[model samples]
Target: MTSRVLIAVTHLLGVGHLARAAALARGLAAAGNEVTLISGGAPAPLVAMDGVRLVQLPPVHIVGTAFSALLGSDGAPAGDTIMEERRRLMMEAVAGLRPDVVITELFPFGRRVLADEFLALAGAARALVPRAAILSSVRDVLVVPSKPGRLEEAHARLLALYDGVLVHGDAAVLPLERSWPVAAEIAPLLHYTGYIDDRPVTPAGEGADGAGEIVVSGGGSAASLPLFRAALGAARSVAGHRWRLLVGRGVPEEAFAALAGEAPAHMTVERARADFPALLARAALSVSQAGYNTVIDIVRARVRAVVVPFEAGRETEQRLRAESLAEAGVWPFAVVPEAGLSAQALAQAVTQTLARPLPPGAAIDRDGVAASVALVACFAQARCRRFPALSRALDEVAAGGGSVALWWRDDDAVAPTPALDRLLSLAAKHALPVAIAAIPAHATQALADRLAGEPLASVLVHGLSHANHAPEGEKKAEFGPHRPLAALCKDAAEGLRRAGETFGAPLLPVFVPPWNRVSDDLAAQLAACGFAGLSAAGKATRPDARRARGLAIAHTHIDPIDWHGGGGLLPLAEIDDRAALAVRARAAAGGEIVLGLLTHHLAQDEATWAFCDDLLAFLLDHPAVVRADARRLFREAGEEEAWCAA
Candidate 1:
């Protein structure tokens, strides 16, 4: 069935809100949904909402950050006539379409002025034959209301009208609670869909024309004149790199013309270019406002940026975003707050940003449009079957004060294969860290060199040799009781030493026995062999789970592979049941133990890969979960114990 969606958006000052909503509308349409976008704000110059039924209401705009006076299209202060007309048209659209989903952009939180229109629209949609799913679409940062009872009012409306809240930002970067005071009250309804990037970016290239140039920009330019002026002043002192300022279209043409005329001979000033993402890719440094669209563009371009936020009046949104974006680690961004925004400060920020290396493309979830549409569809259908079960499982784990930890144990890694490359690619896709269990005797120098370069990859000793030295009619065992105790210890010690020598610091001295069958006596010899941890399948039988020969004993709870059943992935139900049980165990244990996932890349089939892909994606997206390699797990354990002792 084709789902119909209605989106309501009103941008009073800047065009970012409309742009974001339009992008989502277009995305829903592309996903085979009939979409109608009702825009109440004035027509923006370049904003496009194609492929959707566009309905324009009486234009209204706010005068400055005061948001006190609403101006109409005729440039006169709007009265009840414009407000009543806007509400009427909005209501008419909702009543006509009776959409399956209703999305209101920034209502009740940031756009209190449009409460009448949105509230009425929500009420009408709810009264339809089939109640429409209502979603409150909000950006990462919201303007905290100063007036008393504002938050309570927003909370009340959300509790009453909205089915869910779609937060278009990565929670790891900026969660809803940073600026909004009622985050806890509405926690159950909020879903972070990562940052939305509407513009396509060109990959970073070498020796492009704009390389080594300082590129600066203001997102909409209404509040960016100061930043542009300060950038020009800073350019004069920074003599090494070429400086180019792309003034935004939101600045009055006369203002831009005046600034362009006063540009230094060494600097270039022009209106914002369509190739801004490409420009950032080639440029050595980026200077811009901390708007949502511009920040995502900078991150996509993977350039070092200095963000000078626009903080006019009581607007603290950009300032908060600047600081949080820098802290997010998706990219390198320096913040020059309005309090310290000057020629000297801009120059210093530019110099500092340039001193650092350009950051790599972020591994964040940038598929916000698709995720949002899925969420809307799920809520509309009143079914949880539309999305991944793993996602729901993660939400539960996060809500329960527990976390999921995943690690890969690829056995018999003598050299890299196309399959190994594919496995690592999947790991990178989910930003999941891996602990490669290398057979020390069979591990090649080339494999060690490759693992050395991967920042997220760590080396672990699989065994002295993968060869089984068991007696006749016995099961395969390398580090098992079948081997002599002294000889086995020597072999383990040699494997640890060789791995450390080959991979250097990247090698985490963790022993992963072949067949997951290490003898109890041999397990005690790990730390004496310089191993910091031992990872194996199944629960530990040791009474004291911590501090085994100065090593942490972490065992895998789920091995999706059905080893006895042709080495394919086990049934999803079985894997999930095992994982859930392990998570419950950890929660009962006060969240102290790490939940591990064991995998052998060499033995994986197509089904195995798919299971891993879905499973890891969910775990990495979870807020409470922390991805760690064997090295990080042991280090964190040591730190926690030290803290307890202190």
Candidate 2:
């Protein structure tokens, strides 16, 4: 189960992206996987490369915030020749490694200038014999695109090419939706891996180097020159305490020399330290720009701090992270906006931040390295099992010049809950349609509103009220013979009408009985109530007879939950056995059978959810399995014949 993984990362102005990619490579390599990390930016001496195969392309970077102008290592505009060379090197690495998974860091989302190379890498990965699972690696918050159609372009690229996006932060802390506008459309593919922090925890009293000094730093970029100058000016005003300023590596040598010379007697300025986290552990207070790696270090150190986020060039990412974290009150902190930063404002913020009481410990999830590794492994395992026994059976059908159709249905949807969201997310993720049997009496407008964005979901009318009228010692049934024929027919018609009003075009004129049971008398009356189809559990009984009576019947063949065994997931082996039987039955029946997979989201646990996700992925990957859309399956009365004939 050791997968070959290739991670491609390019740092334009800061080294945060490359730093995170390096952490992931180390974690994956430590877990016994063959990991190759390809860097497209200037090499950094601080990033660790232990246990990873490193490939460096001709480095390209941007000066200041001029992202439109790409500069080479020689500080000149990178011409067409250099760009072609970079693409060639990247393609060569991808073709040679033949990795099982390809991870692109912040491409499609941030690096629009390099789309050609990243797109080529994705195409090359897909062209491999066993196509690699392509994923986008991104930070918690992205720089919101202001240009028209930029968001649309990125979203389109993701839907067309990527398998999933690994978000390296917790959703509860800072959900990507707060920054990315189209997050809901791609919610199914987002996997939050917590915050990626590999720094060792320094205990109290362990960092004597910065024991009682006010430590100030900008991340590994020159984006904080103004902040450093303001800090120098603030040192004289904020005064009884000693000040220590750490300049980033991207700062010019002359700039560093000037800052060092201008320092007062109580102030010290130096290059960014390798042991900054240790320094923060014992520092009196931390004052720095709000960047991913910097915030993580501050949070890990449990130090009182003031964050002055870099807001130049309309960059809102740092400001958003700083404000959100301050609002979360995870720890005592202050946010000083960089727009009008000066010595007085920074001095006041720093002094006030020092007066606040420190929290006992951090509340954020910091196991990102392990969590990211596990997520990648899970994705790889799922990909390997994409052609399971059921899929193989369909392959045989395809080899014999035939194909099999499959559809999904979930029952008892009444409202929009977390479980329902998960169910719809799975459908969206696999690009498959799912027919939701909604209890009309309890269905809410909120549920209808939620489905407005999900074009792949359709609704079917469950029995009115979903209430049982059967007598004691009898099986539960809502549309059973216990009620008058007129009453049953009226309820069926009313249910269809209510569902139509709520769901509009997404509503299918189908009747689903409660507990998957309906009396023969009521079944005969469904066509009269304007229902084009009748769906229940197991095989359709007397299908030809039903079609002759102006009704098409489609029944779900497999349910992966153990309803009688404590409502947990049925063993995968048992599910696989049942699926094999279903496929065999479909093949024996002239390949006209549409294999139906049933689920009840309300009753599903984590194990059941995982099984369903895997099942859908398996079905989608098989070349011979055609996913039948519910609308097409039951578009008209007696349409089953036309569908079966095809």
Candidate 3:
């Protein structure tokens, strides 16, 4: 089942938040979801975002490391009008998508600057009838807030609005409590999806591992000037190794040009390259900030490295992550604290990292994309009970060494009406098989031609004329008690002949009477007409109808519409309750059974369409469901003597 997801990301300094969120969006979309990503940061030209619908909001960034002043697109403090506009656009996007999951990047734990917008989005999601899952998407480490009561405030808001917190790092490598003090308070809602790095693991070329080249990268943030200055001095001192310094695009052009001008004969300075990961794979030593994306890339490259934790203002996220990696001994990493960092200290740390042998590998869980998708799927399943019920039924049956069959029967379908076309389209969308019970008398060659175009649409013989002979109509029935046996048998035979002529062999030999009502005499007449199955609405469980006179009986247990009430759809809760009972009945059945779903295309409304979409997706999402036709069901029944005997 493909669900709609809305992910919001606000990156103030670096592209790390937006990049990681984009990775998650790609993962979810690759798993067959319709994803909408709302980003409030400046766009990165090099970062490729595919498979998701992107909504770029008005850009904003922090004023230096203050984290308090918000700068607008013109590089001045954003006025109240700009802030209000951003919030309004953000709210409108959420309301329009009406997504199944609302993922906010670094909210509650970080991104406090945009809390008003995020909280408004969350409130809008809650107000939806079928509310979305409000989730907090945070990185491995959090910048411990220095303000008193800030942790409590974040925790309280999380408890009030968020359903879960997806920590995108392996807890075995660095747990949440190592940096965030209130992790324990939200432990119940915490889920670790490993690290979100989807870079390929192509090993460096033959002689690349021993290249003895030094690689230096400052992350994509304006905060890398100090690191670039120190690295330039270190390049002058490091004698043997060839040095390459990459100033990211986030750094100003003037600073980049200054670093380029100061490059020594033994060094190369340029902008960041797309092959940075490739460079790390071959380098003898790597020096970079302890940003989330970079650290993961370094680990994936498997090179000896030194990290300079960016510690401006109250930002301790990078420093904590760097120290955690060193403490775990995962990589041969030499950490140089940004505070009072000097060129001499950086040069020595680079030398020390180069001298140490690389560890075998880290045991951290790096399956973040897949794990996170699975978790969201489970969360969606839990919220939608129909899926879990259907899943449980399939699992229980499979575990008991039984198989399940499913088929759809659309009653009163004679021609290619718009409603019938929509029903067939829905069936086609899910790859489900649907039997159109066509009234043989009304079945035209045009209808048959239209149906022949659809591979999943099959024809079943509805009763002759579809007219009721039930005296003043106690209820509508084509083969009711008031009808004579001889008349009914003759009509049934004529119906069979008409169906054979109209649909030929493509039409299955199944009889579906109008109003799903049939007599024993009509049942007996089926075999003489060469019918293999009799389908109708029956009890909640299988064998709702029995094998009658050598004809297999398959009844539909699910009908979403309330035909008696102006042809409207039933309440979702009522429909789910009925489905749950059927599932429970199937689980308790002693033998394999086929579950039939009944539908009336002409009588459907919008609510019916929505219900059918969700229900069919849920059923098809399960592995044990085998779409069946009347012929296959009869054949399977013949193969299993138990079905015949029962």
lDDT of each: 0.76, 0.82, 0.79
The 10 consecutive residues of candidate 2 with the worst lDDT sum are 540-549
Q: List the RMSD of every prediction in angstroms.
A: 23.6, 13.7, 14.9
On residues 520-620, what C-alpha lDDT tens digit does candidate 2 reach at each position?
Answer: 77777788899888788764222222242466767787798887788876655566667767777667766365778899999987556756765676676
lDDT of 3 by residue, 1-646 (tens): 7777899998888788988999999999999998899988877766667898888888898755978788887889878888898888888887788888888998887778788989888877765545677788999998866789888778767755676889998898899888877554368678999999877885876576335688889877778878889988988888789888888778889888888999888788888887888888888788888899999888888888888888888678888887887678666567898986888999998877777766796677789999999877776655543334555666777677776678888888777788988988888777788888999999888889888888888888898889988878488888877778888888888888899899986688788888888877667777787788788776664445346666777778889888776676664546666766676675565555678888888887655675676677656656666777765665444432222211
What does the lDDT come to for candidate 3?
0.79
lDDT winner among the candidates? 2
Q: Rank the candidates by lDDT, best first.
A: 2, 3, 1
Task: Between candidates 2 and 3, name the one with more favorable TM-score.
Answer: 2
Which residue pairs show collisions in model 3?
none
Q: In model 2, where do residues sit more than 4 Å from their true spots? A: 384-646
Model 2, position 4: C-alpha lDDT score: 92
TM-score between candidate 1 and the true structure:
0.58
Clashing pairs in 1: none
